[model samples]
Target: MSAAAVPEWLAAEVAALSGAARAGRLPHALLIHEAPGAGGDWLAHFAAQLALCERAAEAPCGSCTACRRVLAWQHPDLTRVAPLEDSRQIRIEQLRDLAAELALTSHAGGYKVGILTPATR
Candidate 1:
């Protein structure tokens, strides 16, 4: 279970987020606002993986047990909230579920990340 090599764009973001995490300055809730096809969701998912990765490095090592799960999209600590089929908006119920997941402890002794994508109408 190793993390994949973080993309350059994602690496930069992780560097910033990692600083915040180290300083205990990260917000409890994160809202990623971006236009369609902007790879906004990808950014969110990469950030989530960095938060959960167990490898030791300035960035994710992509070789730790936790990293592997993240790369495989099986990390229990990462949650993505998006619209359902036939739906045009993200409902409060889905937000609640994300909140619940975030409230729990990380399985790998790391932070749990709830990635909220672009808000729909």
Candidate 2:
């Protein structure tokens, strides 16, 4: 996708996050919080893509293989953990599983992103 996919209001945040990734200063994990409809999901997706982008200089470039996989939820380096409706809460098992996965090597040998959503559900 083009830069148009990211809203103008989140431009600064994305830029800063992208800069961090580019500078190798990005943390292993990040927590994104926002009120409902505040685009937390979108921002997390964007940041995840940036963190995993091979060519971060042109992140979410819409052409790289890594970007494509992330956009399609097929990126091996990206792990999304959200509370299931049945559970309605992030169980200890979920965190433990994520930790185990993070211990392994990434498919792309790059950043491994674990996106935990509905953290309070």
lDDT of 1 by residue, 2-113 (tens): 2354455556666677677667576665666667766666666656655676654533556676666766778888776778887777889999998888888877677887
Q: Can you give the TM-score per candidate against the true fold?
A: 0.71, 0.90
Per-residue C-alpha lDDT of model 2 across residues 1-121, encoded as one tens digit per residue: 5777878888888878878877879866667778888988888888878877777678767778887888788999888888867977888998999999998998888778888888665
What TM-score does candidate 2 get on C-alpha atoms?
Answer: 0.90
How displaced is residue 61 in candidate 2, in Å? 1.0
**Clash totals in order:** 5, 0
Best by TM-score: 2
Model 1: per-residue Cα lDDT at residue 60: 53
How far is each candidate from the true structure, as Cα RMSD in Å? 3.4, 1.5
lDDT of 1: 0.66
For model 1, state the Cα shift of residue 9 in Å: 6.1
